[model samples]
Target: MIAALVSAGAAVPVAPPGLHWSACASGLPQECATVSVPIDYAEPRGDRLDLAISRIRTAKPELRRGVLVIIPGGPGGSGLNRPSTYVKKLPQSVLDRYDLVSFDPRGVGASSPVSCELAPADVTQTAILPWPGPGGDISPTVAWSRRAAAACAKNGGPVYDSINTRNEARDLDAIRRALGERQISYWGVSYGTYVGAVHATMFPGSTDRVVLDSNDDPDPALVERGWAASYAIGVEDRFPDFAAWAAEHEEQYHLGTDVRGAYLRLADRLDRAPLPWPGANPPVLDGNTLRSNVLNGLYSDARFPQLASLMSAALAGGPLPPTTAAPEAALQNTFAVLNATICHDVSWPRDLRAYARDVAADRKAHPLTAGMPRNVYTCAFSPGPAEPPVRVTPDGPPNVLLVQNLRDPATPYRKALNLKRALGDRARMVTVDAGGHGSYLDNGNACGDAEVTRFLTDGTRRDITCRG
Candidate 1:
């Protein structure tokens, strides 16, 4: 058993002892263990938090190269369950060569989870994302941000303040030491891309083959802030794919040949008179909900049918589509971590007028998003970061491979290039001709998957664009 090693007056070791492994309760073919890390790395002797880690060993032990760690998305996303989940999708060749491993970062599931204790209404997607009022007014968003920020401050305690991306990178290094691996490979998605990049920059020698899928800009001045604002550009890039699909299926969807125009008109109509949704959290299929659904639908082509059906139902005066509330506890934890990471990572402008102007401009420019991307977040009211943001430098070895979809809604292609620019020659990209949040092992594009698989299995390197 892993002893209760960290305590008052105890000297924290330079490297933690090996993890005490056991069969996971989930009954998947993976082992589970707990890794104890300091809440504050600067003060290793201080309070510690437990991180849940999991692993699936390579069957071909003689051919095994190293561990491939899966870093999950969102400041709140969990990775402890990934080993079992990814075993199905991962290629046998890659599985044969590397053990699949993952962990829940602090403030996420199975780790030392933190929560703001936010009310159910406050943690809704509409409230958390900062969507502006109908006429592009951001005053309400500002008010909500302030309230949420205060709740997090009062309820989140010390662990919340320690949940920045830099510290997450530090936790990764700690995991490496506990695993006793000289080097490990990583596959990071969405926000995980930023975390992975920071880890590589901070501990370059510890990383072997790195794969960053669906990346975001790593601008030091604006890390998480830039990611929030990129939704406008991402929506614009990916909406066309949805629009084209909806337009082609107009006969079935019944949104007319001008599907985009129909969508805007329907949204405006719903803004004035929302249909009652029986089981939804807010219990209304309002304009903001419609817009939010569109943003989510653009994440994958597969979800297009569901999005279209929702719109079609609303447009045709049929029954409002059903909605399910995310688990209240999970929502609270996710909201807290999101604010803790983004708000504590860097300082955000506190001027509401400045945010108002940005929202106004963004709403006028991108009607689809209605200025949510540029609106205020809880970060505006939260404290500045404890340390400067980690700058992703190009000094690392050239073992990083970035695979991006041309029209990813969450991390648009244009912004993803900024990360490529930040990495310089240390990384190469494989831009796939597809539209989704994840490119490799997702979107089902053979060419894109082949490139990433080749790189992960062996040390293949190149900069290329894959076509459908």
Candidate 2:
């Protein structure tokens, strides 16, 4: 089956400019394109935005099942470039059965961007997201949140306000309609899982086989809040992996011979006196910056080395790793969109007192994450408010399959379980014994991957469990 796909001239079409296609990465001939989607679905005839989309067509077009859309994580991450990156990881039989498709959500990647136009200082990792103090003092965080919110309000425009998961789901339906497909199959990872869920709920009849990996907590009452709180459990789950890695490299990264001791010492030192980060906007490695780096590093196991290197350098009284400034255009646009979607999805309390109370409680519960999870930010800074929130009930077909890692640092398994339960009889779940943000073709176990592939290719799913 794999050999046939290689010879199917799948690589004939050149991916659109800014989009690259490579058979080496996807393990098959791949092509890319840009699909223009409406920024606002309510006004399908309104201003348009280009979504960078990619595809790996089935070897036997006649036997092709249908388009299998791969949704990327981050609410801010791009799937537009995923077909080439993920195709190689899928089973050959799956690749031979359907055309794989992915796209950059609006305001991300090469898609139409919406920026906050924040000051360079505001864009710094520490300043962008407020992480409270070790002792739980949130005064600094409160001030930072206000400033960040103000900057976004002053700069972000309509485009930023327009980006949200509902609209993105609507955009996916539009893509299906454009492709002339009455129904489409889907595979979404991390935040993408949420996208798939929303799509399934909104257009139940328009979906075929569906897979949601590393799912999110779909509490309509607290969308982003739930995601943020999960970080505490997620980090606790994934820390073992990092600990083992650090322990194995004790000679090289001598923060401590034991992982726990090493992590504690590093945290203590950063809290006491941060290193000067030359050329960084703030020119310093504050506690919040350290926290951000830790959170970002935990996204994948492959990044453990980077964390070790940073810890070793900091402990040795050396310069921290070089800080790369986020592209002003990308950060502003991405942040604006992320905030718009999160804030618009639900009504966050305007009471600063309530936020302070939550921050205090969170600080006590999860010291490593500080009180950052509960810190408040204003989403009203965007031009338009979120459209009326649609309650996502599982009215879809029973064709959805959910795959999840037991310990994902970004979207934890517990949260994924919540989503699975919400789907009721509309879906079945495969819990992979793994640790990371994405499953299928990435951090998933063979059993889980095989199950999803079989379901996608032959429409068969397994009722099983996996253990690490």
Candidate 3:
């Protein structure tokens, strides 16, 4: 079941030999290795690329099930270091039964690296997206997209050009083979959910106990570009959650007593004259910066206080906050892989005017986001995708459980439903009334987590919805 003929050319991919695990000195009791895979799956016998892998074998091997991979989010996310953080979170039964494993996907983290070597100006986080000018002008963004594409073309070399999600699915198969598992389970979140879905579509027999959390829409025609636009409505749906949180503690933050008014006022002020935010990537704290930070911060409830404090400091006129998220190397890797997957997945509307119309409309409808979601980006100008998107369908292996939050701003609940409907009878969904991006030991309620854990631990399937 290498390639069941979806869209990544007529060629199916193949995996290299299984792993020879080596000792690693990390916080978690784990071993790391590299699995060789074809850089171009179309030519399985062609040049090879190494994908970094990590594992924490169950302490109680007598009770072992099979390997369960944790596919992280961000087409560029690395789960190699996640087990240490999540060691205490998993139930004893899960810990005893499965080896928690993860890896840095190709062109990400410790895997073979690729880069556009983007200049500082273009590399700025906000600049990475197509940001319209004060009067809704997109000329600058269009120019940047062209320039960025040229840089990627010159510096990304071959591997960067080849980094598409379809190949990532092939890479997942390679990882499975490397682990010597005839069939493996998955705990995939966000973009990883999309990878898991496609892997199932491509290799149905290789899957077991698949849990896709915070799903991506498997709409073959739209793909991630549709996801890019969906964020507008998502922010609209998700803003109230943050607003209410801020309003409840307005006296403490003192931005304003009226939550909506306070947030809007602050944003408006910043747009008029961005505060001098040093050490930050873009360096100036503008409305979109606040909005971008807010959008990211809204992913989990536990980080709500951090957003509040950042806003409080900004409103009170303090020095710039720290600028530390992903290191520059990882950021470079993420930026490259994210664009490679998105732009390569499907063709976006090529006309610039189409973007202008959408952005203007989105701004009016969702001012907190200020049309960012609907705006164009690097993908709009890439040399097009390497392969046509592998169409996703409900035809696949069973025991697939989808746990989604009702209000995920990044991977919105509505988008997840699209995936649920796409999977059809192949999957049963558990919807949580929570308001965050992830589920199953991340942001979901106990009822939802138990549904996933129980299914993984004992193959129990009770398709149910959980209230907040």
Candidate 4:
């Protein structure tokens, strides 16, 4: 039966030959290799690109089960070094049973990276993410979106157009073939979860135990647009966690007992009179900047102090926190891939008035986000997708497990429900009673970790909520 399943309609590519293992340049214990894949899967014999891959073989060959791929977050995230980083965190049972593998998706990291050649100003995190100006005005965001769209289209070429989630899945399949594995298991986080879901849907027969952690909404109509807007819901869901922490440390932060009110008041005050932050990307700390920082800080409990410190400094009108800017080349690569993938994967609404209306409503409904979630993106100005978004459905096998934090700031629990509903009985979800992004091995949630570990090692399946 397993043989029949493996032979039936599975897209095991023959083009990518077996990988030649060599010590990674990172000086880690893992081995690295490159897989040659077509830029356009439809034209397999056409222009090709190289994908960087890394893996750590299980020391206990006797306990070996199969290969487990680590799919990283950020449409532009690089997983080439994940095998090395995660080796210490993953349970010994998992390490002994599976060879941990990862890769830099095409257009990311060492895999023929693409750049939009955007200006340093445009490459800033605030610029790339489409945050609105003061008073929920999206005119600046609109202008930036149009300029960025043109720049990327002019510079990205065919390679940019080819970088979508579907192709990424095809790349994963190619990796599976190169490893000579009939079935590959994976642990996908954030945007990687969407990639994993699409892969499972597109090539169910080739997948083994699938673990989608910190999932995204798999809404076909609003693929990445939905993800962009999810921040509004996610932030609201996770802010109370931050608020409670701030309330506990009120004497240090001095934001008063009403921490939430203090946050809102300070954000509005900064909006009216921005603080000049020298050496910063935009060189100013405003309402949106405060909100963005809070959103980022809510990703983990350890980051609460950082967010609190920034708030305390900002509220006191004292010296502002120093900004740590990323390298220009890295930012260019990330923003380019982010734009290329999101824009090419699905179509976004091009109407400016529509965005204005949504932003206005969203700003009123969720002031903490300041309408950024409903604002315009480069996709609004870019060309339509070559193909429709892949629909994640329950047509696949029931070997998938989804582990989620109840209050994930980036991928909210409410939206993750959409993905869970889409998967139907094909998946069993483990919702952690936590207030951060990642679950399973992360957040120190022993219950969630044990569940995921057992599933990966012995194919155990159970749907239970874990208290963090």
lDDT of 4 at 289: 79
Q: Write down the TM-score for model 3.
A: 0.93
Q: Lowest summed lDDT over 10 consecutive residues: which window, candidate 3? A: 5-14
Native RMSD of candidate 4 (Å): 2.5
- Where in model 3 is the C-alpha error above 4 Å? 1-17, 25-28, 320-326
In model 4, the clashing pairs are none
State the lDDT at 430 in candidate 3.
89
* Model 1 weakest 10-residue run by lDDT: 1-10
Which one wins on lDDT? 4
TM-score: model 2 vs. ground truth: 0.87
Candidate 1, residues 21-83: lDDT per residue as tens digits? 999877878999999999999999999999999999999987788789999899799899899
Clashes of each: 0, 6, 0, 0
Q: Each prediction's Cα lDDT score?
A: 0.88, 0.73, 0.79, 0.88
Residue 239 displacement in candidate 4 (angstroms): 0.3
Cα lDDT tens digits for candidate 3, 282-302: 778887677778887788888
> Candidates sorted by lDDT, descending order?
4, 1, 3, 2
- In terms of TM-score, which candidate is strongest? 4
Candidate 2 residue-wise lDDT, 87-136, digit = tens: 77777777777788887788876677667676666665565565766666
Please give the distance, in angstroms, between residue 361's alpha carbon in candidate 3 and its true position after superposition: 0.7
Comparing 3 and 4 on lDDT, the stronger one: 4
